[model samples]
Target: MIDAILPPAVVAAESFDDPPAELFPEEEAAISRAVDKRRKEFATARLCARRAMAALGVPAAPVLPGPRGAPQWPAGVVGSMTHCDGYRAAVLGRAEHVTSVGIDAEPDGPLPPGVLGEIALPEEQEHLRALAASRPGVHWDRMLFSAKESVYKTWFPLTGRWLGFEEAVVALDPAAGSFEARLLVPGPVVDGTKVTGFAGRWLAERGLVVTAIVLPSAGP
Candidate 1:
């Protein structure tokens, strides 16, 4: 996923085909009261995240949920995580070189009726129909939802503001296997510059739809 979407220097990713069943004490407390299913997902995501951190030479550490339920990474690390049926992944990059990151995965399935109306703009729905007409096989509605989620994950850490699904327009390029999020609200400042949009990559394969966004550090 990292190689398909990000520059080699910008990020590294780790994934789990089999989710671990154990959770560290701290990680357990992170979702101590949640249901069994929630706990498993929580623990598995951390396991993936820790491995990603270790691969970057960072010490083993607990990734606890922070404000807005975003995973809090150790100092000097910027990363993201996503988990879906049978798939979980984490991507990490050095804070000095990467500003923020967001990743998401979803089962390749149709969005519930009326879901597209809620999450998509008028133009997006039209384009989605075209995509479905041509591609026909991929679940473009669900892919759009996942892409919007990835955008929010990338945006919140940068601006600390809420961005609704309708607030960001996602345009997918099937030819390039990527997507771009056009921010409809005031954008974030990166490298001292206010950028209007973000670039992301998406892939649909192996019964999953995955999307990622990496904001490389605008160096100080």
Candidate 2:
């Protein structure tokens, strides 16, 4: 499901079932103090991440979280991981071919009551309302949340800065299955280009909403 949204430069691996809890010694120590559910999710997500790294022709390594809980990748690699109930996925790319990657997954359901107001700006709320009216089946609010996650995932790697939920305004195109996040804060510079926003694709199917953003390396 994650592969559908990412570019060819990215290698994506996803699993619907939780595998046995296996982890590298370092990875286990990172989450050893967490609850059982957190441990399981962390293990499964790293498993998916190793598969993606192998597909990208990189040797497998323990994926430990760095600052802000972002997965630290091997040198010369950029990637992201996300896991939710019944699903986990990882996507990776070589830094020479791809600038950065961000992917997220969530249940295809409405945002919990009142949560949207806190995360979404007023303009985004109006846009989501129109989308909800036109496409009643999809949970636009939830999709917006997922898109923001992807945006921040992409943003942090490039800038090493925090982006608040309200700092990026997302506009989702229901027909295109795509969204764009315009950063209200100062943006990052990548490959000599200043990135003011990120454009990504989203898919809602099989009871999940997945979003991905892949920025390619700048041409010489």
Candidate 3:
């Protein structure tokens, strides 16, 4: 039932385990059947997460459900998850003692012109301009969209607040296989959280874009 698959990384991963017809339980409900596609999307993400942890030699700990429907990792592990139209991904590391991590994947597509203005700050707009000039025909909109979602997944658990797109700035360096972000306002998710230089990569093959965020050990 799980036809879609994520690429093999050093991390632990699984195909859809929940029903193939739907990713999440039917009780969760979807606005439309198409949204149900995300069920498989989410399922694969968790599977990949488990695999990624195992690859790291981390034990097979339960993904405990947190108060706000977030996945809680085994003690000493820090990680994050995300799923889009066709793919899902997760990354794990030792908790406070190890490092914080986040991952995201998005389909390549056009970005509505209006969205670029709405979500991007002035500096971000400039950055996008350069991306566009360099990679004409590539959708900057989609890139920005995935970038912010990656940022949220990377920063939110630490601060626990929902983030807005404009609140942060992103700088991408395609040549180096990485990008950077600077979160301006904290909001509830990462209050006063100054992530001056967060880095990540975009894997174009296998129809997936991934990001990995690592924070210093915020623990004993």
Give the candidate order by descending TM-score: 2, 1, 3
Sort the candidates on lDDT, descending order. Answer: 2, 1, 3
Tens digits of lDDT, candidate 1, 114-215: 888999999899989999998888999999999999999999888888889999898988888888889898897788899788899988887888888988
Using lDDT as the measure, which candidate wins? 2
C-alpha lDDT values of all predictions: 0.84, 0.92, 0.60
Would you estimate the TM-scores of all the predictions? 0.94, 0.97, 0.72
lDDT of 2 by residue, 85-148 (tens): 9999999999988888889999999899999999999999999999999999899999999999
Q: Using alpha carbons, what is the TM-score of model 1?
A: 0.94
Candidate 1: count of backbone clashes, pairs at least 3 residues apart or interchain: 0
* Per-residue lDDT of 97 in model 3: 47
- Could you list the CA RMSD of all candidates, in the order they appear? 1.7, 1.0, 5.8
